[model samples]
Target: MSVSSQHEGLCLRYPEPLGPQANVSYEAAVSMLMRAIQLAQHTPFVWGYIDKPQEGHIYLIFMTQQLPFPPDGIRYQDQEQKIIMPAGPGRELEVMEVKFGFVPNSSDTTAWRVRRRYRMHKGGHPQLVLIHYGRGQPMPIMPNLNQPVRNYPLRPINEPALFVMGEKIGQKVYPNQHSGPAERPGPPGMGMSFGGIGNQQAMLAQQNNNLEALERRSQRDRSGSMNARAPPPARIEDDDSADESDMMSTRTLALTRYKRNHELMNEVFMYAAFSRKKEFPPPKSPYSVFDIANVEARVAKMTAEIDELRSKAEARREARSNADGAVGDDPGDVSMEVSGTTEEVPT
Candidate 1:
């Protein structure tokens, strides 16, 4: 028998029997055997193997749910008699049993049953049991072994791994194909089952397809591309007070006056230093021109205002230059100073 990497190296070369005992001493023997399996290399999360006298031959029953491969290439030899019980999946061992004589056809059985119970702290874990029955002996009452299941999202395992966790029940099985055994035997050396090893591979493939379909539907829902309606356009109300338009018109007139004042100021400054500067024209009416003393007073007020604006502009420019220098000195600081004065000089 060839050894497999997945289940190799864990083999026990027991010149000493792991369980060398009698049928009457079966309970004690199983207890000792279980402890040995626990200490063995690559001890599966939950598993056990025991030998007991049944009929004429020693019934070597090995049952496990966690191990990837069946215990193969491992054996017990009665050195005194030279009898060898080689290890293989159900071929050299009994397949597990749920109840005595429930379905007695194969010499070796490896059946398993799984039940899920909700846990307050851990959420959920599978309760797996593997029981094997020897010929003409009542099924042994086994202790419940607790193993932490990997609560991974259901996905298809490849052909090899699927064979390891063999014959999954409950949520582990997939849809399609009748729920029974296969017509022909599966691949060579693989166990006999509803669809053999191929059934498990098919079940995994179907599970993958189902998950892919669900993911596609979830993506479509997230994109909001299914029977969705666009939002309505925002509406504007035309209802406003009759004086609203009048207010806008007044604002426009004020802006026009401000612009005209700016143009007049520029023209006055342009002529201030010109040799051909025109003389100030008198108003068409004497009332518009005002008395000479009043005109002189208005000119004096305008000159004072111009001087104040120049002082403010120079101060603002100096402040901005200082701010620029500060910014250059401190790379992290931001300067937000106005560059020049912008006083609205009333005419």
Candidate 2:
């Protein structure tokens, strides 16, 4: 019976692939080596690194000259050293063990950590070995590598390399026969950034200015002023309040003009219909011409009528005032005072 001890970085056995009578193959060995190499390659080494040739593992030091202190585990592995893969479970006695310590070199001392693990399996035209991002544990044993995993590196080199290197390796791994011409630059023509909402906004503003100018001109014309040539004021802010106000004002002006035009048209139509009626013929005087003597006579008659009305009003007012004054001044006396000058005498 195999006894297991657990620790921070302890490597435990894989379940199905373990137990008695399990055969290990060259392919398994190669895969395990690849896994180890892949882990190390992905594990970045900064100013210093450790070599553990005995366990077939490497410890990378993460104390650079630039840093003030040796960072914590994940920080040491990830940020300071810029390593991608994490250190796995470290155990002893057939389990993956990572030995870490600080080795002082001159003025600075760097912390070093290493991870290692292995398993054996069989049965395939080409046998399968699997590795992934976890502390090695006995589970429904790691899956067969024959089936592909998407977005995960298949081989060890893939985990460490950059995009360009991966692309080249990818092409090598799965060769394609098809070839094509190089891709061309961006969109055609005199390429300008004026094709979007900015252009539309500018155009709308210009149209609004034109509308305002026309509206001002129309207002001036309706008021019968030739010297009136003024444009609408500029909008100060580009916020919701300004937008709502502008829209409301524009709608009001449009409605007003529409109503005015409709009324004018209706009046014109009514006048036309009335003029065509059989009872009243068109006026005989297209532009009525009257003699100067006739005009003078009419003016004199109008003046005489006005004067008569004015005299009557004045006489009434004077009579009312005198009667009131006499009544108040002498209640017992009711005397009548009449004069041809109706303006002053009571009737």
The local distance difference test score of each candidate is 0.30, 0.30
Q: Please report, as a residue range, the 10-residue window in candidate 2 with the lowest summed lDDT.
A: 161-170
Residue 163, candidate 2: C-alpha displacement in angstroms? 80
Candidate number of the best TM-score: 1
User: How would you encode candidate 2's per-residue C-alpha lDDT over 212-276 as one tens digit per residue?
Assistant: 44334334443542244354245332222432332223433354458768898999998887876
Mark the regions of model 2 whose C-alpha exceeds 4 Å error after superposition: 1-288, 331-347
- Rate residue 192 of model 1 by lDDT: 9
Clashing pairs in 2: 9-89, 9-90, 10-89, 10-90, 10-91
